[model samples]
Target chain A: MQKLTKEQQDYQNFVKQKRPKPPLLKNILMAFIVGGLICVVGQVIMNFYISRGMSPKEAGAPTSATMVFLGAFLTGLGVYDKIGKRAGAGSIVPITGFANSIVSPAMEFKREGYVFGVAAKMFVVAGPVIVYGMCSAVVIGLIYYILKL
Target chain B: MAGKKMGLQTIRFQNPPSIIATSSIVGPKEGQGPLKDYFDLILNDNMYKEKSWEKAERKILKEAVEMAIKNSNLPYSKIEYFIAGDLLNQIISAGFAARELGFPFFGIYGACSTAAEGLGLGAIIIDGGFADNLVVATSSHYCTAERQYRFPLELGNQSPPTAQWTVTGAGAAVISSRPQNPRITYVTTGKVIDMGETNPNDMGTAMAPAAVDTIVRHFNDTNRTPDDYDLIVTGDLASIGKDIAEELIKQKGFDVSNKYTDCGLMIFDPQQDVHAGGSGCACAAVVTFGYLYKEMMKGKYNRILLVATGALLSTTSTQQGETIPCIAHAVAIENL
Candidate 1:
């Protein structure tokens, strides 16, 4: 075996020095609480829509849309990014996160004007998600329809 | 002049360029990251009083370059070249910033690997005796990158949790023929690698193989093991990519398990909601120039292996269903 050089040996020594431990417990606690709260708000909104004489099936779209709207609104007001900065993946996976994604780009391009700048940039992040989502949806829908036949 | 080419893609410099100074400027979001204090400047606002995101991106590049020169204690006119690029369309950020810097500019585009690419080029230029002092800089603003590459932020669409966030920042380093510590000793240029990954949402996976290829090549050519370096860093591979690279490197018989890390992962805390972690040209740039550079200068790190990874896909290519092609450039920095 080749002898370890002074630099190589020194690296090993320095690496063993006390490094800041990962903030595991605090992060997990924050994610759990924030994620749970988001789900609760979603459930409450869904229930509110259903209580207004709308069937559960009919309320699904509006509930999701309302959450998305709130997400976008918060993102526009620069609140979601702040919460997201603190909440981690908990805030990112929610429907509001999706709204935040779209609105975040739109707000950034607001100076480029409404039609070209804002509208064009509106779907940059989520466009791929939607395009793939729609293509799969169409294929799956066709397959299901044919299966029923 | 190009340096002497050694094994596969290695470049053995005649006179290695020394990093005289480095400066990194990040947005407020990145300012709150774990390495916040390492940065030279962090704007509290994304706009930074600029009218447009593109303009703000250029401003960051300009400021970073100016800061690097100032920190180098070198006159701006003494620098011979400005080798830089950014994620904006046509890399306008670098181009516009170059106009302000008044240097002989060489506009490059290596996606997130622009920082390494610029450094590699600058090192070669200085080593080849082309010029004495050169500057390498790159920037990427989250908003500008978002609008150009993906969707506008205004749409309020949801991004997959696997999606990587573009770092809003700029990094600049002044490289001189004058002797100094933490010099760029060696460089390994990477070839484009694509394994048919089409999902743009999960970039970490798509770029991992490229990083693996470059790391393996660098190790093989240099005849050095992972034990030689204090740390090995990949540009924008994030968490998922870093894991894949570690596995792939193990398969290549190096076993760089403990020494390896990704700048994307290192920039922000895991609890900071950066999805798959950071991406963009500035991701690696800011981390290296801002954080790692200082640590190395303090003699905290004796040697570092930097492999800056870049996804070589454009908006039109991804839209056309072309699989994402990725590249990685490796540079060995050692303090002596």
Candidate 2:
């Protein structure tokens, strides 16, 4: 076997010296603040839906859908992305964030006529994931149901 | 202006190459294994028979180009020119690949945006009548890139949340004269922008400004509103950068509310360990080639503006405490 070159050995030493340390207190604090904000938004939405007399299950469904829709809309209107810029993972970690992933492209191509631009290519970014997610969820749900039976 | 009077008509191609080919040899995921183990995985394999990083990239590029050409069913000799580049110091990957391919080559570097730049230029060459058939290819390997721009993979280092996964891949496309396909009609070159970011670890922040700069230029150069193109796609400006880009575009007084999409945000499962989304040259290449191409071919999209952005930074520069400088290149593709 060929011996490692001096450059390779030096690189190995350099990497050992530069290994990243754990996140500092400031990093943790920032994550908490940002994460809390996103959760607060979700809670407010749920409360609003419940106050409107919807059942808890129904409220949860609509609230989640609404968040996704809003995220997607903002992503399209180019607003959600702005919030995400300032908030980082705070904005990206939520379910609504995924909706933005779906709609931004659709909104972008609205100029090419609705069928081709809006309807066809809008989901280019998020389509596969959604399909895969839904399929997997269904399969998992069925398996759980069968096991229960 | 030199070739403008030639009345060079822009022609489109039908059945363009889909971005199914990729060359991603090294990255964070692959770095976890032992150096000897990883080297064996890369070198002992059929893919890495070449002696050096440059040679491996060239081999991958050649294969990708050949695959694209074969998939397009165009004869090798019919390809009028080959335009390409990489993130390497002198872009030797593209140069070597071009040399081996034996076609006229035009090398360019726009960091991760080289893929779009090459495609845009290839489109222009064909449209301008300088050539009827052209090939555009770009590649980057995590192994070569790490030594050039960051730490060696042997060291177990953690990436910041803001860091993007540099896609270990290469992609190629054939632009030819087939009237039924999408045609590259317009291109807007962007100026380099620096938002004063010095952290090499967080590229999204660094690249966001560049993406914004180029998107703004595309709007200005074409005198078209956001409503003109079906989608405005930015390359490699993952989660954080995508957000910043949207904000910057809004600051320009145009509402891209419904039309902004980012390639970096698309390629990976964020929950499955890809933190900020996929990046590197392949981020835009694979998504544009694999996902977008198929949809477009199915008559899903008519007009699209692909604006790929990049941060031009090296490890040496970063270690020296130099600021991150970003650039973006835009290409307009229309299906007639």
lDDT of each: 0.86, 0.67
lDDT of 1 by residue, B183-297 (tens): 9999999999876666687788778878988989988888988999999999998876777778768878988888899999989888877887999999999999999999999
- Model 1 lDDT tens row, A1-149: 23445643542243223222346676667667887898899999999988999999998899899999989888877688767755766787788888887788778777888988679978867788789989999999999999999
The numbered model that scores best in TM-score is 1
TM-score of each: 0.77, 0.61
Candidate 2 error regions (>4 Å): A1-149, B1-54
Most accurate candidate by lDDT = 1
- Model 1 TM-score on a 0 to 1 scale: 0.77
Highest DockQ, which number?
1
